[model samples]
Target: MPENDVIAAGARTVIRLPRPADQAEFLARVRDSAALHHPWLAPPATPADFRAYLERLTEPQTEGFLVCERESGALAGFVNINAIVRRAFLSGALGYAAFVPYAGRGHMSEGIGLVVRHAFTDLGLHRLEINVQPGNTASIALAKRAGFRLEGFSPDYLFIAGAWRDHERWALTAEMTADGPGAGR
Candidate 1:
């Protein structure tokens, strides 16, 4: 994605690429949202950590996007597409977090829909997947609302919070929707 590229636009929010300058405000929000994110996520809360986060996303296999409220241009959350594979599978995994102030406000749902659309159309990928901890109901809800279907459950899908956690795999494909490229919109 290009710098500041507007990936998608919704009534309440816009999804765009994260910029280096967003470190200060993004870290501040992450710090303030520590409680809200505990046990569910652990986004970068310091300048150095945030920089490292950005660096990882700078790799060819990863992409980071920020969901910002259109009215104030304040970040509501972020979605990252990781492990992109292009040759045959044409798929990627998704990870995201909704900030404290924006949690439960439907920003993530809208943002995720946008990201799904971008993944299928702009990125030319066939499928996008999200792996959510079984206990994270909010994340699962967002994935379902955005049209991802529950595939299966894995015993030790990911190592999070210093332990191997079970995860529910959810996925969506461009071919699954009748509306084709405009389905997510």
Candidate 2:
């Protein structure tokens, strides 16, 4: 795949997987957002750790992308389609977050919409799930905007911010894409 052609939603941004050359830039972004993201994302741990994390996500079994500003090429955020399960069920979980500076700009919603289309139409995934803490209104809103239905809540589902938090489960199916819900603009 072309490094620049991974996905685009024509919303002043693009989504594509990170390359090794991006390590220094990506590390800087992670460091800058340490406080805002530590509650959910591991706090970088180390430069090597960040590289390893990115390398793992680039594997065939996982699909991950960085949200970049079209004009400036700034690293705004990231999204991941992980833990793919192919068997009786073809599914994966979606996780995403924008740097504090990029929040509230609607970039995440647009990036997610593009990735969802790729997951269903290009990757042929059947289902996508998102787990968000009860208090994360922004994430919950993004999920809804991307046409994921609130399936239910899972108590103590994940250890976030040093505590186990209840998560609201949201999901979208490939069928929903054909119907226009998960279709990108």
User: Could you say which candidate leads in lDDT?
Assistant: 1
Candidate 2 residue lDDT tens string, 1-185? 34455566556888887777777877777777787665665634467887787878867778888888777777788889988887767799998878768877977887888888788777878899999987778788889899999999999998866788889999999878753445554
Model 1, span 18-62: residue lDDT tens: 878899889888887888777876788778888899899889889
Looking at candidate 1, the ten consecutive residues that score lowest on lDDT are: 176-185
lDDT against the true structure, per candidate, is 0.87, 0.80
How many residue pairs clash in each candidate at the backbone level? 0, 0
Model 2 off-target regions past 4 Å? 1-5, 43-45, 178-185
Q: Quote each prediction's TM-score.
A: 0.92, 0.86
TM match of model 1 to true structure: 0.92
RMSD, one per candidate, in order: 2.8, 3.1
Clashes (candidate 1): 0
RMSD of 1: 2.8
